[model samples]
Target: MKDKKQLFLSFLMIVVLALMLPMSALGAPGNDAPPDPAYAKWGRIAVQEVKAKYPEDKVVDYLHVGRKTNNQETIETFKLWLEGETKEFGVIIDIHFDTDTEKITNIQFKETSR
Candidate 1:
């Protein structure tokens, strides 16, 4: 009976620690709440930052920002600024929309070749 009790306690401790591991690993020491994604500042920042690298007209498609089609609530499968003729934008920039604000978190150049 004593062995069984010890084994059960060990298993419970293992399970508890397993649950805690993810939480601890996922967060920084002082962080309590997850970041907010929907802030307007987020989207504005993406456009402003990417604009420095490419012209606004060069920006073909990005969520959170206004779309040519004027549609909202879309992700991934959308219009993308691409190489028209000059290969100027050979790689389409992927703009990540913040989950909380529906704003762009950042922009990254796609690795796939045009």
Candidate 2:
């Protein structure tokens, strides 16, 4: 009876260890790739405006060109690369907003090549 009990306990221990091994492996820490940066509200709106203005084209790439501030207003710029049925080009969009109110005052775009 003692030997039988010992053998059963040993088998149970082995089963438990086998089950836990995979869980531990999954939980172990390792290098994980960083998540991509999310686009800001102005950036999203710029993309939408571009799509609207060029319905036949598709935006392929994006770049946030940074921001500038003055006494009464702030300016944010973004560059977007687009692909059309006939050609590929880039656009620079400028968003001007009030510094105190944070309201958009103007939006402009300029097309570029390369």
* Highest TM-score model number: 2
Q: What is the C-alpha local distance difference test score of each model? A: 0.50, 0.83
> What is the alpha-carbon lDDT of model 2 when measured against the actual structure?
0.83
TM-scores for all candidates: the values are 0.28, 0.65
Error of 2 at 5 (Å): 68
True-structure RMSD for candidate 2: 20.1
Tell me each candidate's RMSD, in Å, in order: 19.0, 20.1
**Model 2: colliding residue pairs:** none
Task: List residue ranges in candidate 2 displaced over 4 A.
Answer: 1-39
Global lDDT of model 1: 0.50
